[model samples]
Target: MAEIQVNEDEVQVGAETASVCPACQALLSDGTIQGKSVLYCTKCRGLLLPIANFLPLVEFLRTLRRPTGSDIQPRDNSDADRHFTCPQCGKSMTGHPYGGPGNVNIDTCESCSVIWLDRNELQRIVMAPDHYPVYSRYDSGGGLRRTN
Candidate 1:
């Protein structure tokens, strides 16, 4: 995997430019997840997803039925303690538990609005028992609405 130096001011990866993986520092190849463009690391198989694509991906995953007998579990808090730098912004990424049933901790860059998810984190979230109504809280016109 080719190592690339990412600029701190770079907010997004262009289709013509390459990126580096935040986890393994490997070359990040452009890829699609659930029809949304994302960056994938060949070495660690991790995914770097822009925050804009997050809600859509979750909504799509919600449409699928959970597989029977699946026993995936979220990583411990120690996993979140590991510091990660955003490949896009070159800033420290904050780690937090994903606001859903899986209890998966994800690294997020508030400045760049990007997220880093290790392998299988997406699967655990998709198979969560309850759906995450992130976009549903907003009205069709994009205004926030109260949910009972």
Candidate 2:
């Protein structure tokens, strides 16, 4: 496990003493999205999310999606050419298209079980057309409500 320290402008990884952004090599800052903790790069707007937290977040997002009449699209290998090293383990991370309805490519570090999402990737997933189970779900009369 990596110990994370979050100050006003930077995040430090305890064992290594530094946690730089995978996308921009800039220092990362601690941040939260939908109340889930993450390390964010101010320069690149990329995010580093723990797999433990991300899985539940994805499950919650899935609950918001309307049932798809069709199956998900097949994944593409266009992102395979790009590679990233894990900030925690210093091993090469695997890049693959996210398995959800969205087409964003995400990087995962198997050793550390962390994920790296580039700028706007999360927004793309959240705004995907298939994700709108019903716009009314956001209204007071609906059963669902935004948490963060």
Candidate 3:
């Protein structure tokens, strides 16, 4: 009797991916039981893989997060959602519940192309220093500065 063999490459490996992307909310399945971590964005084709044990790759992975859109435009919230006025743009911010590391809840301003990250939302994006620049005032020569 001959045993049937299966090719790993012939299989579609994405459907069983465990986690979903924090930014786009897409599946990130291709997993290996966490001997290490792989952070990838299927929609954006961004992949983050750790090299060895406890390397700095995770830090780099966390920093890989970038703004997918300038702002998430307003929508009907009759489905029970929280609202916030963007500190950067003063627009009613519509938030999305994020389930990544810190579980950041984020919102955006459509009028001014600014994002409103609630509480520790920035931490989930990147573990580097959290320094967000807000531009509301114009200086003498049209330069930008952080205001109080």
Candidate 4:
């Protein structure tokens, strides 16, 4: 089993099962990042995450992460065209730019219901500015309430 350090206070113990990374073809180690289970590639620092956990993981990380005040770097347009085989299912993964804040490209294997994030991609998404649209509704008393 492999042990990974998440931070000063948290240490992630690897699972007994072994898997390979789809990005770099390196061994993927099981561990938790921000309390969510994930298969992490130590070589390329990529992450293989269950589709169900992706949103929750992003939300949790964004909540804990503050803006670094550094300029947001642009994502590589070519990455959106790259494809990879799913490590779990051996199927072609769909690559696309995430429709969220960070402008990061993500690869998903719908057959296996998994998402792949390259090195620093998670951090990019969390650090990107939150730009959710705000909606306003009128209450029973005609008072405007903001929803978002």
Give the per-residue lDDT of model 4 (tens digit) for 35-148: 788887777878888989989888887777756523344566768777798888888999988888776899999998899998678877876667533435655654333443
Evaluated at residue 33, the lDDT of candidate 2 is 55
- Candidate 4 regions with alpha-carbon error over 4 angstroms: 1-17, 132-148
List runs of model 2 lying over 4 Å from the truth: 1-17, 58-79, 131-148
Q: lDDT of model 4 at residue 52?
A: 93
* Weakest 10 consecutive residues of candidate 4 by summed lDDT: 8-17
Q: Which pairs clash in model 2?
A: 66-133
Q: Which wins on lDDT, candidate 3 or candidate 4?
A: 4
Against the unseen true structure, what C-alpha lDDT does each candidate score?
0.68, 0.65, 0.39, 0.74
Ranking by TM-score: 4, 1, 2, 3
Candidate of highest TM-score:
4
RMSD of 3: 14.7
Query: What root-mean-square deviation over C-alphas does model 4 reach?
Result: 10.0
Order candidates by lDDT, high to low.
Answer: 4, 1, 2, 3
Over all chains combined, what TM-score does candidate 3 have? 0.27
Off by over 4 Å in 3: 1-80, 98-102, 127-148
Error of 1 at 76 (Å): 1.8
Per-residue lDDT, model 4, residue 97, is 87
Is 1 or 4 the stronger prediction by TM-score? 4
